[model samples]
Target chain A: MRRLLPALIALALLTGLSLLVGATNLFDSPLDRSMVLAVSRLPRTMAAILAGAGLALAGVVIQQTMRNRLVEPGLTGTPEAAMIGLLGVTLLAPGAALLTKMSVAALSALLGTAGFFALSTRVPRRDPMLLPLVGLIYGGILGAAALFIAWSTDLVQFVGIWQTGDFSGVLRGRYELLWLIAALAGLLWLFTDRLTILGLGEDRARALGLNVRQTVLAGLTIVAIAVAVVVVTVGAMPFVGLVVPNIVSRLWGDNLRDNLGLVAVMGGGFVLASDVIGRLVRWPYEIPAATIFAIGGAAIFLWLLNHPKAHAHG
Target chain B: MIDIDHLTLERDGRVILDDISLRLPRGGITAIIGPNGAGKSTLLHCLAGLLAPRSGRVRVLGRDIHHIPARERARLLALLTQSPGTVPRLSVRDLVAFGRWPHHRGRPGPTDHALVAQALERFALTPLAARDVETLSGGQKQRAFVAMAYAQSTPWMLLDEPLSALDPKYIRDIMDRLRDLAPPRHGLTEAPAASRSVLLVLHDLQIAWRYADWFVCLKDGKLLAHGPRDTTVTADLLSALYDTPLRLERVSDSSVILPA
Candidate 1:
């Protein structure tokens, strides 16, 4: 509880900042301010927070499930698989309901993540870096295929927005799907110990009376839903999951049940702060949160690689 | 006691354990000794109910091990695999406390907490209970894992090379702790009243000979010999088992196996 205080305070500050700093001036009239706050600012801030928390939770789940520290939903072909599903829906039904598209994307992302899990088993454990590299390559292949389809179908513009995470377009009705992450986070909380047992690998988990296959599928299902929902709502946030979980694990240990709340809070803070910064970087004009996070997250990733604390692979 | 009836296992169309049949008496430490690829670890896995053989059955304490549900089976047997993969950055107490998982599922009760504390105390890990498992030395890490298996409070412990990389001090520390936990055996027929029966795969023949009350030797996936240490283990059998000359010699009232 003591550890959570500072984080909660910082997140509260970020949430307020996210609501205040935006393209529109909220001070013109009380009615306009309230209208803008309710319709645009509130929804965008909530979207960033929800999407961040969901991605971080997904990141930790996949990392523990695969027993690799450097992996997350973005690298595991999840977003690309989700993009393909979205494209397929766009091509087939052209006007399919958003819910239908989301379900399809989530299912496709599950299959894609399952493919990475299969490939992960064949990867030798001699190097911890190898699995993430493999995930990168696997995601690259899926992404390349998605890009080709998008180009051929003349849906390149649609694909571009989904590929980069931005919150400028978020409104009350559009980003409601991201609330699925909150439900998924609650679901993840129930499976906390099982997910931690997963880090022990197959033999140990089974020895502990855990159904390893079922638990893994459950975990990956959560990851797929969370990732797909975020992609569909605000586009892909690359390193929110990757960086938040790693930082939380470094400060606190890997006891998923105990540290989950902190991870979610910190994750929300990380992305919301990035979004707030994106709004203010060039006063009136805006930058995508994904671009800011990519620059910051890449630097942190490099630092984590060189740090001795990151030697959990051994 | 473990009963193996015509057990055979094949991997990738190649037989790993071919028609192996043996009964390992319960109540004491039984070391499965063999050369590399002799399927010692594989047989241990079968005994722990983690692996199912192709042909036959394994019965532990009168129940078909393979048929038992995983949760019930966990209450009966605990297994510590060799190099249990990546150690999560969990505290030592938390890792050991996972032994009570089968009982509490996820919500650990007071009994679970008490047992975990007892396990920590018994393993001399109370001082390091709050430390992260990944920060421990190789031997300390091994002890923490053993403490976890111990905390499971099962009737049987099937360990695969629990002492693989430990130095002599840690090996002796672990062996001594295990010796204290196993029921005292007077003869092969004496059944243990309540204590755990340990079955381990050992690469160190000296440690095995020092601590194990029974021996199960395998060569090329076949049982070479199995009985009390004094009756079943012979210099000639040890030599044939490893395809190298070995001698059993006594020095200062203790028996030792050395390459000859």
Candidate 2:
């Protein structure tokens, strides 16, 4: 709770800044502010916050279920797979509504994630660390396939396209789908301890009358949907999941119920900070949210790796 | 009562347990002792319904354990395998509290907390209950796991090498706890209230001989001996079980098999 105060205060300041400043000078008057705030900043910040919270929560679930600390939705190819699905929907169903596209992307991401888990289990070696390695290799393979598809198509430039998640285009209709992340996060919070128990190891769970495989499938499903939702709405933003959960766990230790709540709040704060930084770093020449996050996240990950106290759980 | 008739377990086309038949009395600790790779663990898995026999059946209290609903079966018996995966950050109290999950699902009530408290005190984990299980010493961690199993309050506890890594003190502590445990809500007519039955895959012959009321021995996936310890745990049988000459020493409660 003490540590949470600082984070909460930081979140308020950064999120407000993220909402006020955009492509140009900040408006001071209430009447002057409502239009800019409503049009661009609100949608963008909301998108960023929802994506951040959802991805981080998904990361915590994946890492726990696999019993591997380094594992995340990004590491396991859920985001990449969802990106591919989003691209496909944009191409094949270009006439479809955004809602339909998001749903298609989510479903494809779910299948792809299940495929990754299935292929990983069949690799003759089920070492926990092998999960991320296998997932990376597996994602690389699917990425190549996605690349091949892109090359064969005339829509290659538009194939892996994204809106920059800056919410420059978001209105009432565009940003509404982003609110689904809150619902997903709520469901996860309700079942947090159950997932933790499932992750402790299957034999113990089985002895306690948990349907081990069912619980695992449920966890994987949650991760899949969360990744897909973020990817469809915001494009490929890696490491939000990895970064948020790792930071929260270190600060609070690993009590799932509490850690999950912290992950959502910190996740929202992280994306907001990144978005604000992205807006300021280039000023008029705005930086993309994904690129800004990539640089910052990579630095944090490198620092984590070099830290002597850090064990292999980033 | 567990009645097993012609039970066989095969893995990857290799027999791990062959045509074994036995009727275990409802209320006695039955030790499954054998040399390494003698299907001791496999038999325990089959009994716990975690694995199915290729060709036979295991009836626990007249119910086919393997075919029963997993949750119901878990309520009846608990299986603790060796080297159960470590949960990096859960506390002793939370881990043990999981044992009550079968009864309560995710909604642990006051009874669950009460049971966890009782289990913590019973296992002397009150001080360590709130600490991360990963931070515990080996013996403490083993005791924590045993306490979790005990918290299950099942009629039969099937443990696979529960004493492998512990020092002598942990081994004795765990053994004494097992001996003194009472299977919850089970008031047997013949087996006294404080007596719990355990089916353990034990390597240390002395501990088995001293603590177990009955014995079963296996060699190369086949049953070699079963029944009263005095008759089955003979010096000749012990030597044959390990393929070496062995000597026996009579202790106060039982005897020890030592290699020659």
Candidate 3:
């Protein structure tokens, strides 16, 4: 009961802010005020919520499976790898459907994450701290691969696909597919306890009757798909995954099930807030979601360095 | 029963365990003791299926430990490694509840809750049920971890240096609890139609002498001696295992002292 009040207040504030942002307009729409509401504000807000929730949920699960506090979808290179896939398809096919593009991105993301897991497990790399370091390196490698391909093909526009995260481009037709990804994130919530057990370390997980390898693989797979869709739909929101889940954990507890639900809401709130700030900071001109998140996230990371939340939440 | 046949473990260029063959009958506390680098923990890890031996086989209950499905293997055995980092927000009950991961896979049912509650109570952690594990003292965290492994409800429990940093009282308490659980009394010794055995990598020779029913001693990555504690507790063998002169003397009615 004591904890309930604060959470409710936070929720209400987020919802109110989201609505307020939904009402703000960039264009004096030739179509009218109602058109802007139905078209731009509504769908973009929904996509931001869905993408935010999905990425944050993925971060929570990945953190659990990897048993590390610093890990996030972007750090592990899944989103970067997915962007590479999207860049390839967007440049080459030029006519690929959203689903086809998502599939390609998902596959690439899985491969990237699996590669990270494989290297960590097989190479006597016991430093859990180094896991994220390795991930950053892996992501760098993939990011470079993508840039090289895009540069060679002269698809400079495609190269910017993952450079920033922006919900402004999310229209109803293209953004609705993210709901499928979000739904899958919801489904993964069913096994939150399993991911929590995996966090206890692999041997304990196995002893408790969890398929440790499978749980980890499955968890990573979910993160891959969620991040792939997030990348394809909304571009790469770097620390949104890292920040929202970490905050949710500090506020709540380590029960992944509870954290998953809370993070989805919190993540949506955080991204929506940033999106709104982007609108206001330079109204009508608008800012990229990733850029806003980058500035906000770096501040949060610096704050976390001073008052560590990973230890608090993890 | 835990059986290792011709097990060979290697790291870098050095062999850790060379053709080591052993069987731990279910249902007693077995201590694996050795000097600084005798591969005690290595053997324990191989037996737990956390590490696959370079060659040979480890069969826990007539099933290849590594080959067995991970979830089923977890249901059968639990491993407690040296002082793993704590999850900051996890309460004692929540920590213990993780033992049921293999059983519940996250959708913890009523039985899982009951088991967690029981484990917390058994370990005298009911009071700290809501306190974060990270805030607990070293001894308290060890107790929490042990309770978690117990909550796993597996027939076999493998611990590496569980007694490190614990005071004598906590050590005795833990040993007494495990002794009570070791077969013919509690259900811990009921594995693979045989005695339920607890294999531990121990640094304190006295603890090994006082509590361990069986011993597996290693030296220079080789099996030096193994048997019932009484048979293998000689000072000469102990000294050889450590590459130094060692002595085991009765210090008190309830304690044995080994000169470090």
Candidate 4:
């Protein structure tokens, strides 16, 4: 409880600041103020928080199921697969409802994640670095395929918008699909113990009577839905997943049931802080949250690579 | 009690365990001793229901093991693999607590907590309970895993080379604990009526001879010999089993087998 207080406070402050920092002054015009808050500011704030929380939760599931810390939905080609699905749907039915696009994207993300899991089996476990490298190459191939399809269909600009995460475009109705992440987050919490047991390896988890295959598939599907929602709504939030969960696991340990709330709090706080900073850095203009996160996340990831503590287990 | 009837397992056109059958009775420590490629670990996996034999059946405590619900089967048997993978940043206590998963299924009660505590104390892991398993020494990590299996409170334990990579002291420590968990010898107070029946795949013949009450030897995925350890295990049998010349000699109260 003591540990959570400060994070909660920080999240509240960032959320408040995110709601107040846009172009329109909140106090100057009461009528337009509440309208702006309702239409754009409130939705943007919620989108950042939900996407962050969902991605972090997804990262935990992916890392635990694959037994690798470096792999996340982005690294495993999830967002790229989602992009391919979105492109396919757009080509097939350009006027499809937002929910239809999200469902198709989620299904493709699941398939892509499953493909990454299948490839992971052939990689030797001796080198911890090898698996992530394989994931990177796999993601690279999928990303290239998505790019080619986007080029052929003349949807390259649309693909570009989905590749970098930004909250500026988020509006009242446009961002509600990200609420699915709230449900996905609940689903992840329900399976926290199973996911933690999965990190102990398939044989040990089986010995403990966990249905390893079902638990893994469930986890991957949750990850897919969470990533798909984020991709469809706010674009790919690069290392928010990789960085947030790693940090939380480092400080709090890997007992998912115990640390999941913290992961969610810290993740929501991190992205909210990023969005607020993005608003402030250019004043009236804005930088994408993905760019800011990538800068900070890459530094943390590099430090994690060289950190002596990481070598203790691997 | 456990029964295997003509179990045969094949992987990618290669036979692992071929038409092998054996019965392991309840109580006491039963050691499966074999050379490399003897399917010792594979056989243990089959008994634990982690592997499905291509043909034949395995029955545990009167019910077909594979047919039993996974959670029910877990309650009946706990397997400690040779190389239990590490869950990063998991505390020793949390790792051991997972043994009770089948009992509570994620909602641990006070009884589960008490059992986890008892398991930690039994394995002398109370002092290190809060420590991350990843930071523990190899022997300590092995002890923690054994404690987890012990915490399962199952009637049967199937271990695959629990003593592998351990120093002599750790080996003796584990074997002694396993021996105590098995039914006591005459004049000694038995562990309990519900003491575990241990079946382990062993590479250390000396340790197996010292601690195991029953022995099952395998060679090339086939049953070589099995019976009471004192009768079935001999210099000639071991020599033929390993395809080498060896002799067993009594050294004071204990016996040691060596090259002839």
Candidate 5:
């Protein structure tokens, strides 16, 4: 509880700031302010928190399942694959429901993540950086494919919307799908022990009577759903997953059952804080939380690379 | 008892273990010893049901190992492989707790917690229970891994080269623990009454000769010899197994092997 106090406080403060700092002043007109709060400000804050928490939880699962800390859903071609699925559905039915698009996106994300996992097995583990580098390139390739498809279909502008993660477009109904991440978080709690066992490597996990393949598939599915819902709702929020889980693991430890709630809280807090900063930095205008987090996340990642206690593979 | 019948494993056209047959008796320490690349680890893996033999089957206590569910197999036997991978930032107690996974399947009962505590105490790891596994010395890490295997509470424990890079003190410490856990003595205060049967792939012939009651010697993936250690582990058999002359010297009621 003591460890969580700061994060909870931060969350509360940022949520308040998020509600008050928007273009329509909260105190300017009582009815208008309440309307804005109910419709736009509240949904935006919830979106930021849910997306952040979901991505961070997904990041932990990917890191644990792959036995490497550097990898996350965004780096593993998940968002790109999800984008590709969205693009395909848009082209095919043109009027597909949001749920339909999300399902397709989740499916493709799972396949792409599974492909990356398959590729990861062949890459030698002598150097840890090699896997993440491979994932980055894999994500790049998938992104290129999505861009190519978007160009041909004349949906490049739509693709651009998803390429930047902004909560400005999030309204009440538009962002509820991200609640699936909350469900995913619950699933993660249920499977926390199995996921931790996976970090021990295949032989150990199998020796412990865990169905290694089944556990991995379940973890990847959760990651896919989380990434896909976030992308479908608020675009791609890069680095939240990677950065939040690393921070929590460094502060606490890798015992997922114990650290998961803290990881989610930190992740939600980080994104909410980022969104608040993005809102205030431009004043009446806004900056995408993705851009701000990418800048900060990259710096921390570099420091993590050079830290003496970092794993040799890094 | 564990039984292997005509078990053969071939990988990538290279025979790892060819036409091997053996029966490992229950309730004692059985050592698998051989030259490098003699399939000592491979045979151990086959016995543990980690590797599937190309032709034959392994049976543990009248049940075919591979045919049973994986959780059931884990309950029957525990295997500690060479250079076991570590989960970063994991505490010693948490790693040891994983051994009870097969028994409780994630919802660990009080009995599981009590057994983990006992295993920690038995391995002298109680002091380091809260320490990260990565921070431990190599010997301590090895002991933690062994403690995890012990915590599994299986009747059979199969270890592969668990003493490859340990100091004399650690080596002796682990051997003594294994010896005590074998027949005629229960493993720990919290453990069930059944004595554990330990099978390890060992290169240190001295430790094997000191602690192991039964021997399974292999050469070129074939069963060279196996039986009660005193009777079958003669100087000539040892010499032929290594293709080099090795004499057994009786020193103060315990024997040591030296190059002849």
Candidate 6:
């Protein structure tokens, strides 16, 4: 809990700053101060926090389940699969309810993740870096397919919104689906021990009386739902999942049951800070949070690739 | 006692363990020795109920090993595979505590805590309990893993090459610990507390000769010899098992195997 103090403080300060630094200044504007906070500012901050936490949780789950720290929900074709589902729903029933669209996205994301897992087995195990490379290419193919479909159907603008993570359009009613991430995090808490066992690999997990198949399916399902919900509500944030869990795991170790809360807080803090920076960089004009995360995330990813010794087991 | 009757396992149209049968009496360290590709680890997996044989069965303490549920089997016997993959970034204490998982099934009780603490103390890992397992040296990590299996508190342990890459110091350290903790007790239906029968696959002949009380030799997936080490193991059998000329020699206080 003491380790969480710094993250909690940073998150609280970011939340305060997020509410204050909008186009309509709370102190000077004619708009009703309370209405803006309730409708836009509060929901935006909560959406960022929820999405960041959920992605980080998803990243850790997939990493443990796959026994590879280099992969994340973004690289595993999860968000791309969700995009395909959203495109299909939008084409079939443009006026479908948000819940229905989210359900479809979640289902497709699960299938996509499952497909990647199937592909992962065929990749040779001698090189740990190979799996993530395969995941990246797999995600790229799915993403290209989604882009092609969007172009043909004239849903390109909608795809852009889901591809780029921005908080400018968030309001109370628009972003509630991200709250599903909170519930997913709670569900993960229940299976923390099981997930830790999974990192030990199939034979050891089986020897320890863990039903490896069941635990892995449960973990991947949670990842799919979290990634899909975040994408449908606030668009895809690429490296929040990839970078945050790696950082936390390096700092506090991989005791999932003990560090779940810390991972969530740190994830929320990182993304919120990114969003705040994106907002401040151009003042009235805004940059997407995903853009800022990518710039930082790619650098960290490169460092991780170079420093494989830090992750080597024996 | 473990009763193996006509046990056979085939993988990808290749017979790994051909028709083989043996009764392994409980107590003492039983070493399964064989050359490369002799199906030693495969047989260990079958005994642990992690793999099912194509024909015949293995019975542990009169119950069909494969027929038992996973959790119940875990309680009955613990298995440690060769060079366990993916070093989880867990602390030494937490890794050892995982041994009590079968008993608690996620919610550990006082007994589990006591056993984990006892296991750490017995393995002399109290000083490193808070250290991440990944940071430990090879010997220390092997000891930590051994402690984990020890903490499982099962009546039987099946280990695949536990001393494969360890130095003589660690090998002797672990063998001595196991010997003192689970000395062979003859003709007893019930095992006393802290006593376990260990079955392991070994590649180091000298270490096996020094530590193992019984020998089970395999070659080309067929059992060649098995019984008390003094009676069943000979220089000729050792040579046949590895297809290399070897002689059993008395080296002062203990016997050692050397190429003839």
* lDDT, candidate 6, B164-259, per-residue tens: 788989889988888876686454343466578988999998888888888899988999988888888999999889889999999898998889
lDDT of 3 by residue, B64-131 (tens): 99888777877788889876755546777778877887787656899999989988888889888888
True contacts kept of each: 0.76, 0.59, 0.63, 0.73, 0.51, 0.75
lDDT of 6 by residue, A202-277 (tens): 8888999998889989999999999999889889888888898888787678888778888999888878878888
Give the lowest summed-lDDT range of ten residues in model 5 chain B: B184-193
Better of 2 and 6 by DockQ: 6
Query: What DockQ does each prediction reach against the true complex?
Result: 0.61, 0.48, 0.47, 0.57, 0.45, 0.57
- The CA lDDT at B250 in model 6 is 93
Error in Å for residue A300 of model 2: 3.1
Alpha carbon lDDT of each predicted model: 0.90, 0.77, 0.78, 0.88, 0.87, 0.88
Say which prediction, candidate 4 or candidate 6, comes out ahead on DockQ: 6
Candidate rank order under DockQ? 1, 6, 4, 2, 3, 5
| Candidate 4: residue pairs that collide | none
Question: Which digits, one per residue and each the tens of the lDDT, describe model 5 over residues B196-233?
Answer: 88889999999889888788999999999998788889
Off by over 4 Å in 4: A27-31, A304-314, B184-192
lDDT score, candidate 4, position A182:
88
Of the pair 1 and 6, which is ahead by TM-score? Answer: 1
Question: Which candidate wins on lDDT?
Answer: 1
For A1-314, candidate 5 gives per-residue lDDT tens digits of: 55677778878888888888876677766566677889999999999999999999999999998999888888899999999999999999889999999999999999999999999999898788899999999999999999999999899998898888889898988999989989889888999999888888888788778899999999999999999999999999888888888877775678887788889988888888788888888888888888888887788777875673622110
**Which residue pairs clash in candidate 1?**
none
Q: What is the TM-score of chain B alone in each candidate?
A: 0.97, 0.93, 0.91, 0.95, 0.95, 0.96
Query: Model 5: residues >4 Å from true position, as ranges?
Result: A29-31, A302-314, B183-193
Worst 10 residues of 4 chain B by lDDT: B184-193
Runs in model 6 deviating more than 4 A are A299-314, B185-193
Candidate 6, position A91, lDDT:
95
Evaluated at residue B107, the lDDT of candidate 3 is: 69
